[model samples]
Target: MVRGAPSGDLSGKTVLVVGANVGIGLEASKHFARMQPARLIIACRSEAKGKVALAEIERETGYNGCEPWIVDLANFASVIAFADKFKREGGDLHILVMNAAIALPVYQPTIDGWETILQVNYLATSLLSLLLIPQLVAAGRKSTVPSRMVIVSSGVLYWLTPAKEIETSLKPLETLGSEEWCIPNHMQSRYSESKLLNLFFVRALTDRLRSVTPLSTIAVTPGFCYSQLRRVWYEKPTFSFVKIVLAIHERLLAWTAEQGSRQLIFAAVGGRDDEENMKGGFVSRGRLVEVADFVLSDEGHRMQDTVWNETIDILSGVSDKISPIVRDYLVVPDSSIN
Candidate 1:
């Protein structure tokens, strides 16, 4: 049942998809182009690669409304600049897809001083999302339909628990991203933990925004798909036998990248009649699904707030402007959850 989104017109909406040059990001961008949004911003890591994606989309869909922008998730400065640029140039944001992520075989700290996976997947992602919330709120309030924010996560999260070291730390996200706290044996789980953080963030954001405006923020898992996301397994040195096993295993079970992208499209604009089901929901292969048992657990709820507060504290420090935006737009976190 892997397919593009069902017939839907994106005529008035403005859409942005990050990490759109390859893998699911690329495929989703292509599909979005066909829907013909008012504007389609393809945010990539570099200008050259982004232009290539833009060209391909235009050629494939004959959609002239697409533009390419560069934003590096590892660089907070870059993310801030892109947000400022988008706001100055546009009125209200409609569809925002936070689609960029990384899976590294080892812990490598970025120049920004956060471990690569945590920064790209969570911290910087949160930074960008926070900066854009006001615009989302504005668009949502004016329109009868809810604006959409899709946080791409993975189902692999069901198989992970916070490493004891990360769990014991007072700051779970900070510890998970800190080189000093990295457990030698825990490197393999970093990617999975990052996805868990996404789900936590979606729940936190959705709960806080319920009364604020017409916005639906949903977390989605594209399911295991054949993607360049696992390039690290091929690029970095490992036992040849191990590489063979990983490759074959994925080849046998994975969906095509295009197949995975459909779920993203479905999340972005699907469920118009049942928008309530999508608010704070998770979807797989275009169907609404419950989060894992742990995500619905009492402890999981508490941990999500911890992650949200720490995220706000860290991101608020990045720019003084963030404080006013959060205060003016987003409602205060529900005390019941705290």
Candidate 2:
């Protein structure tokens, strides 16, 4: 069981939880709403589903500050539009949670031509984070309280293939939007790889923000939780046996969504006294833990640097208005890039 709740009051602050329609995101949204934020935005791809979630959260928590916003991570254009709209009209964002993620039982490519898991979980996620840095920074400057950007990473990242191996297999930077590199049989591996990328992104972004911004960027894993994340795998025809095994495991071992979301809540709002130490660190089960050795190795650092540069290059092409600081952060010694 998780050990803490958000220690701070959210009065007058604006919080946004992306992909909050179901699972851990939904539960986390409800948790945040109860803290009495000035405004709570529940962002999802489906406005209909998002509205339903918005209503449910308000009904259950009696926190009427919640509203729904549309953001389809599978579509890069949608991500761009959402960010642009938020920048233009959304008020200062004190807390931003990148909690939405997808896991596919079968490989599929998004309209953007990148694999679905990669697009929704990593690429578009990186795009939105870069686009919103200016707002987070602005909000951080004005608020007496620390502003935060939380990335919902997973501990399963440790089980993924080595960074160098996965990088060589995908050569993602070179094959940005191409389907030729994605294999149908590799869907599960791809999902794990995406989560690993989340860790890398958190580390890279935290390094960039250290000297320039007060915004706290951190990553946390909710541990193994029973959530809708695995529904697709269970529903698919090819996985009936796998579904049975998962059902049994969930019944006996997995934490309920609400139980699991505590980690998210804690990571988002707890440990305020040590927020600086939490930056770029990985939290699991409500405690900051050491990262896997592979993630700290020399090769691992190279992998993170490569992913950071490639991500910036991709998002820069999509939106020419990226913040100057974000662009400059991607600038590393030429040796680092190679």
Candidate 3:
């Protein structure tokens, strides 16, 4: 199907799939497995689920080098621990797919007391990627080719709150429950806000990486695949009917999870070595497309800088936490020559 991948032969690369336990993420793990990569790490929230998912991927792809790493993307402490563990274990990484997320049923706070969906879907991802930057950079220096950062952002970002509405202050979701706080009726809009952040974060990182490193960054939507994430879009009885419709819809107009992986495949290893052809771009419907929102405007870059600086301020303790790990993991010389 979908003519396989352009070159599904990752015989010597290391791919790390966030949220590899389910949905499009699981499918991505299988895709990487088929590429016959040297190592496939399924970064998952649950150890048991990760093991089972790994087994299934190996069974399906006949590529047995795949393994799993426990990671909870919602909590900052957990992310720090995961990164430290990777460094301690000498885990070299090539590709980092920021794919795991939490969808709120009713608004709640994460363990660190931040809004759940935004915390899990955006802020935590930004932090984890930053923490792993040293390792990623190390791998890139060692690689003979360009390494990649495939940020799985959303196409729906174009439809949400305008770039102007993203407040600098952390607003409480409880404020929205009041009748006076009404701007609209849908809470789903908050999820949209988080997706919008994904775009801004990637854009900011893209610019920073363009100046500092050769490791390319590309943000892309995975099209619409059938997954647990659809629970947010439809209700139960409606969900049943919607599934029936979707089954027929797929028969008429949809791609499988494998087909949907094309954008990522291309971003990771496809395309010619042309800077204009790739890098700091967004992919959708299996093609490199301009990010279609005010987020891509000049004012958009200003907005991104503001948000990014504020984010760095908020996550100030991150790099400091890695310092201890670096001390422990680095091979200190016996003595310095005077």
Tens digit of lDDT per residue, candidate 1, span 1-338? 66556558888888999889999999999888998999999999999999899898989899999989999999999999999998898679899999999988777998889999999998888889878887887888888898999999999877877766665556887778777767566777888989999999988988777475788999999999889888888986656775898789887888988899999999998888999879888989788988887778777787888788888899888877788877776776666742
Candidates ranked by lDDT: 1, 2, 3
Best by TM-score: 1
Question: Which residue segments of model 2 deviate by more than 4 Å?
Answer: 163-165, 168-170, 173-178, 210-212, 237-239, 323-325, 328-338
lDDT of 3 at 318: 49
RMSD of each: 1.7, 2.6, 7.4
lDDT of each: 0.86, 0.81, 0.69
lDDT per residue for candidate 3 within 56-114, as digits (tens), equals: 89789798998799989778888888888878874667888888876654656678777
Best by lDDT: 1
lDDT pick, better of 1 and 2: 1
TM-score of 3: 0.82
TM-score of each: 0.95, 0.92, 0.82
| Model 3 worst lDDT run, 10 consecutive residues | 329-338
lDDT of 3: 0.69
